[model samples]
Target: MRLGALGTSSIAWRRTLPTAVRVPEVDLVALAGRSADKAERFAAHFGCAAESGFDALLERPDVEAVYISLPTALHHEWAAKAIRAGKHVLVEKPVGVDAREARELCALAEEHDVVLRENFMFLHHPQHSFVRDLLEKGRLGTLSSFHAAFCIPPLPADDIRYASDMGGGALLDVGVYPLRAAGLLLGPGVRVAGATLRTRATDGLDLSGQALLVSPSGVLAHIAFGFEHAYASTYTLWGDRARVTVDRAFTPPPAYEPVVLLEEQGHQERFTLPAADQLGACLASFAAAVRAGGTDSAREGADLRHDTVAAMELVEAVRREAVRVTVDQ
Candidate 1:
């Protein structure tokens, strides 16, 4: 797929684009940014053309698809535009600010007959599949509950994550990881039972929060995330006969081996998994869908669309049910 990038965001520079260039199915055609110089720099680094604005990049006939690494608030707007232009879209995670926006984008993609996918690259990692296989094989016995956390130390005050108008907050930025993990591990029909969101008194942006969710089958999920804690990225699944913990649940570097610990009656074991490029895998999947075309493209995108909407709905539910608290800066 000949791909255009719609932003010069840090993630695009550091992770997405670098991995994208290594994917055999992807062709980096152009990059667009508000700043011409920055766009040029990124395009030069990636061996692609640079455009001064998004419209210019979209107008290029060589671009069959676009990867949007824009801010949370801009995802729906640009993604909708790209879909309307008859180009496949791969927007960064959280797909939109809320469920409503996600649904709208999905509908638009269907109407325009283009593929739309949210960039939840972690979902493509094999470690998750390995965990699922273990659960299916009864290694953990009857699943009862799940616990996940993806917290990080505070960022520089000037970071976009701290800007409210840009759809910045802990819930959208980091909390989504655990929430999505809950859905991935526990499956659909998971609903938030309770939630709490802590907002900074000065900016009214959320700083930290937690949620308790329950699956229809009585499986429980306790997820916590924040931007005001030590770096932690892990999740544990508790079952009747045993429990398994993933030490690096999210954001593992391409070359980093992941560790999964299993604890059983009077015994414990550690399993080390091979390093994998999840971003590269994700891009290849998107490229394959684009190449599929017609009915195949739509069929391939259906699950992704469902997952995107479902994840956004969970985020919306958390925000709605959260007991809001104000923390003094």
Candidate 2:
């Protein structure tokens, strides 16, 4: 699958592009950025061509698919355009600012007979499959509760994530990780029970937040995220008979070994999982889906579209139901 990139963002330069170039199934064809110098630099670094602009990249006949690392606000617009151009699209997470935008983009992809996917790269990590195996074997017994948190130190004032109009907020950025993880572990039909947000008085962008959700079977999930805290990315699942905790749950570096802790009555166990390149795995999956291009591909696309829309719906619900608190800073 010939792939073009639509942004010179950090994730594109740091993770996605490097991984794409390594995937045998993917051919890195071109890169586009608003700044020609940056685009040329990125393309040169990755050994691909540099396009004049995003539209130019999309217009390339050699580009069969596009990776959109643009800001959250630009996701729907560029993804819609790419789908209409008959290009499979892999967009950064949060797919859109809200559910409506997500639904519209999905509809466009389906109408144009193209594949549209959101880049939740963590889901591609093998550690998650390992956890599922433990769950299936009753390692955690009957699940009773889950807790997740993803927090980070504040960014520079000029970072795009501090701009409200650009879809910047803890919820859209880090909060979505725990939220999506909940759905991944708890299954579908999880509903927001209550929520809270701490917003900056100057810009109304959320700095931190917490949410409570319950699955259909009554298992509870507690999720917390923030842009003003010591870094943490972890989750714990509690069951009637035992409990399991995962450190570095969300953004593990490709070479970092992950450890899962399991505890029961008078016994504790630790399992260390192999290091894996999740971003490479994610890009490879996208390439395979684009290459498949038939009923099977269509089914995968439909399933991914559904997951994207469902995640957005959960985000929207949190925003709507959250008890708002403004901070003077």
Candidate 3:
């Protein structure tokens, strides 16, 4: 698959471009940036063509797919444009600022007969499969509750996440990591039980928040996320007879060994999961989906769309229930 990237964003440089190049199924072919100089620099580094803008990149017949890593607010716009141009898209997480937009994107993808995938790269990791296996085998002894947290220290004032118009918020940023993890462990049909959001005083952008979600079967997930705290990305599952804990649940390096801590009856069992390149897996999966096109229908795409809707619904509900916190108050 010949892949192009829209926007020379930081993630494209650090993770997306480098990882996509490593995927055997993907060919990093082009990049588009608002600035010609930045686009050329990124394209040179990745050994691809540099287009002056997204529209120019889209015009290239060789670009079969695109990775949209622009600001959150621009995802829907550019992703829709790419789909309309008959190019498959791998958008950054929170594919849209809300459920309505996500639904629209899914519809556009369907209408255009192209594949659309949100880049929740962590889901592609093998460690998650290992955890799922334990649950399927009843090793966790009937799941009860799950707790996840993905908090990070503050960024500079100029960071895009602090900009309210750009879909910046704690819930949209680090929060989505644990929220998606919650769905993974509990199920997709989770409902928000309650939530609290803290917004920036100056512009009303969320900086921290937490929520409780309950599944139809009564399973619960407690998710906490923030942008002004110590760094941590982890989750723990509690069951009737056992508990499992994993560290670095969101951003583990390709070679980083994953360890799952299992506790039962005062005995601690630790399992070492094999290291894998989750970003590569993500890119490869999307490329394969594009190659298959509409001929081979995929349940994963449908499930992803469903999950995206559920997540955005929960986010809005939490926002409505939130009690704003500001620097003055």
Q: lDDT for every model?
A: 0.91, 0.90, 0.87
Which stretches of candidate 1 lie above 4 Å from their native place? 294-300
lDDT of 2 by residue, 184-269 (tens): 98998899999999999987899999999999999999999999999999999999989999998989999999999999999999
Give the CA lDDT, 0 to 100, for residue 108 in model 1.
Answer: 88
Clash counts per candidate, in order, are 0, 0, 0
lDDT at position 180, candidate 2: 90
- lDDT: which is higher, 1 or 3? 1
Candidate 3 TM-score, C-alpha based: 0.97
The TM-score that candidate 1 achieves is: 0.98
Supply the TM-score for candidate 2: 0.97
lDDT of 3 at 174: 85
lDDT score for candidate 2 against the true structure: 0.90
State the lDDT of candidate 3 residue by residue for 260-313, as single tens digits. 999999799999988988899999888888888642236777787678777777
